[model samples]
Target: MENQKKVFIIYHSGYGHTKVQAEAVLSGANSVDGVDAELIDAKEAAGNLDRIDQADAIIFGSPTYMGTISAEFKSFMDASSSKWMEQSWKNKIAGGFTNSSSQSGDKTGTLQALSVFAAQHGMIWVGLDLPPGNNSSQGSEENLNRMGASLGAMAQSLADQGPEITPPDADQKTAHYYGARVAQAALRWAA
Candidate 1:
């Protein structure tokens, strides 16, 4: 497994939906034969900086609130200042996913924020590679990337619903695909 790639998923979920999405991403990354993915909640990542520094790729996830990443996620990004200063994460693959209550809930803003944070850390950004799904008459709602996000996975969950009832299967599948894609990219980068 010398060629194996290690990916760390760092995220914060206010109501658990984002955690589910993170799990899907982890599952997808684990599907790759030489990829090992681990989930670290943003709230708890302070103790895991070593893992982050050792990772070949990092995938960030967050719930969109007020048109951007949740406060907890923002805090995590802010705390990475030391890494930024030292360029510890430089050139590592970076990707992200975000969830919101509405289809157009400015999820892009969150994605943009994540991308910018990654860029500032000198990480290479990875975009979702899947074509837009559920965009045509023949497309099914079950299709992946139905939200048409190019930068990362965008997921919609009902405001009143719990994680178990929202972010639908399609969104989770999109996240899974995104994780797999990032891991693959990380593997290639390592090679």
Candidate 2:
């Protein structure tokens, strides 16, 4: 695994649902033979630009709150100002994921914010490449990309349900695919 690429999943999960999605992303990244992935909570990631700098790619995840990224994840983004000033993340690969109670839930705003954030750092953004799932009678709940997310993985979780039940298998699979896609992009960038 010499010269192996590292993918960091930096996120903030309020009710543990987003954590489940983060884990899926990690699993997908690790599935790539030489790619290493780790999940780091936003609280723990604060002021930790070194890890971000060293990683080949960084995938951001945050529970959508008020139609945008959660404040906790926003704090992490704010803390990276130094890195921004230094342009340390410039040209690095970046992607994002978000979860909410409703299917739409303004999830696009969160993803858009992530894209802008990545762009501010001069990072190349990677998007989910899958088509919409659960769109027709032929589409199964088990299919991936049910949300038709293109900017990144988007998940819906019932406010009353636990992570075990929501975000469904489909959303998790979408996250998995998104993660693998990012890893592949990182590999290409590294090469």
Candidate 3:
């Protein structure tokens, strides 16, 4: 009987790269029918389990540093121990994203960390519907340059693009498409 799907994106951005991508992902998720999306700094999300408890689906994101989830995000994960113990997130939908300065910036490590946490919470995971390979420029647009974003919903932005630039149109579209897919899945399962 729920009328809407809520997606909570929890992310840690060390130098703003992941923050930008997280926003793009939110924009995408918000575009989906009957979906509401919001982004929370890792610290806040970790501290306020009530907000997290309200979400129908959760997306984790962070910049890959030393090939792993940033300490900020990891701290949030660690803080979720209470929810894990309570089985507060069991059966919820989960997804992840990351960014790095190198083309292969140990991004997968971040996703691995997230996946492990979700599994521990007994959550269901969602995969990127489109493959990174052979896209005919349906291409994730993340492929244009060489930065480390291959894991999860990875993306690249000029580290120095300043605040003037926004998530590129293609990337935003991809995010929206990803959002719609996940939203539909969340709705289906919730029903």
lDDT score, candidate 3, position 123: 93
Model 2 alpha-carbon miss at residue 82, Å: 0.6
Q: Give Cα-based local distance difference scores for all models.
A: 0.91, 0.92, 0.75
Q: Which tens-of-lDDT digit does each residue in 56-110 have in candidate 2? A: 9999999999999999999999999899999999988999999999989999999
Better of 2 and 3 by lDDT: 2
Task: Give per-residue lDDT, candidate 3, residue 151.
Answer: 37
- Rank by lDDT (best first): 2, 1, 3
Worst lDDT run of 10 residues, candidate 1, spans: 43-52
Q: Count the backbone clashes (under 3 Å) in each candidate.
A: 0, 0, 4
- The true-versus-predicted C-alpha distance at residue 30 of model 3, in Å, is 1.0
| Model 1: per-residue Cα lDDT over 62-178, one tens digit each | 999999999999888878887888999999999999999898899999999999999998899999989998899999879899999999988988899999888899999999999
Model 2 stretches astray by more than 4 angstroms:
none
Q: What lDDT is obtained when candidate 1 is compared to the true structure?
A: 0.91
What's every prediction's RMSD, in angstroms? 1.0, 1.0, 3.2
Enumerate residue pairs that collide in model 2.
none
| Model 3 TM-score relative to the real fold | 0.85
